[model samples]
Target: MERAYKYELLDKYIDQELSDKERQELDALMTEDEEFKEEVEVAVMMNASFNVEQKQRWAKLLEAEATKTSVQPSQPTKTSETDTDQKETKVRQLQPRTRWLRIAAMLLPAVFALFLYLFLANSSQTAPQMADHYLSNRHQAPTITMSQGNDLSQNWKTAIKAYQEEKYESAANLLEPLTNSTNATAEQHFYLGLTYLYKEKAEPVKAIQQFEKSQQLNPAQYSAEGNWYIALAHLKNDDWTKAKPLLEQIVANKDWKWQTAKEILEEQE
Candidate 1:
């Protein structure tokens, strides 16, 4: 009976919706059953990995909806306690093992994307459509329109303009060519990583790759940023063990990114 009960809690455990008592029960089961513990770990990883693409897709859907309703779009208005209670009741009636936790976790990346889009849109009123299209297509921005003899500052200005217009791909493409120049510095790689990070919703794999490249190219100051991206990649890939170390490094860093890194680490806990 205890063995059967432990199996029953698998879904809840994966979704992280188990009550304190139920969790305690699961701990006891795992202590006595190594196989059961491994099974639960696999299930949790599977759940996180399977849900990654779905979460990104939902973020795109929300982006499309927001674009369509551009003028003061109806936001995900904060829910009241009564509404939450009602939803919880409905959820219990329908979902076999609680799905709210999955949905909530899925919202994190989407919220980040939304905020990024809003920031870019507000800054690029002159080319709103281009910005929106770029974001929607998840393409990188083209490099600066530099005719020969353009100064470094001028090139960076162009890159910043592209970034402000939310042409992350273009910004990245522009910065990519510069990284090969003898004068290129760590800041360039860091900015390139920033471009990839912005497009995380559309091309997470690419983002991870670029972030890794940034770390390799500039380890002095961008190591923390690289580690943060690594953690996010691990989170997206459902490789908790792989992510934990990188997240720990970022959390320990006394940098501005630490606050956000700490928050994410806490969530995983």
Candidate 2:
């Protein structure tokens, strides 16, 4: 009946007073009547007695949709905040590792360079070949050869014999001419000094001069004997200050001369 007379039920539908069967019939009529559906929908909205549950449900749905729409803008902002926090944490975590790696990178090269410099310096300073060369040069014997003759110079032989007999002045007189010769060897200076020592004339100073000459010719040759005799000469002259180093060298030799040199050194001390 409501569908046959749809306009008659409009008031009752707006008032929300239609029976369940009549409401079903009116809904079916409204589906086919576009103008009538619009009229009824407007009237029901204006009516004070519209369906309370439907109004409440529609208000709740609208509020939920508003909340969803409002929250959409904030979602991106929240994502950005989370991303920023994660980035900050990552930067913080990486900073110390980066700093330490930079420091290590800087220091590693310096340490390696320093080590290399030291190694090269030591290698240059202490080269085995250089050391051997220096030792060979320092210990080399002097180029002074004795001339062999069937008729030996009687003056030289007489001086040598006088030295063997401990006749120091006679030997010195004979040896002086040979020492004055430009061709004189270090051995001539040594024998001349021994003559002066035994004669007790210019003992320490003469011995010191001859020892220094021997060292200049050959650092290794007669060094122990020369040093010992120099110390003995200085001791005889009572020059303790000059004698000490030579005496010390003589004592360190650990040879047969050491005992005699030590005894002389003790007497001076």
Alpha-carbon lDDT of model 2: 0.61
Per-residue lDDT of candidate 2, residues 92-189 (tens digit):
77667556555554556564443333322222332222222222212211222365544456777777777777777988898888877776667767
For 143-217, candidate 1 gives per-residue lDDT tens digits of 555573375576677777788798777887787787667777666766666676565343445656666766776
List where candidate 2 sits over 4 angstroms from the true fold. 1-152, 200-202, 253-256, 266-269
**Candidate 1: regions farther than 4 A off:** 1-150, 180-183, 212-218, 253-256
The lDDT per prediction is: 0.62, 0.61
TM-score versus the correct structure, for each prediction: 0.39, 0.41
Worst 10 residues of 2 by lDDT: 133-142
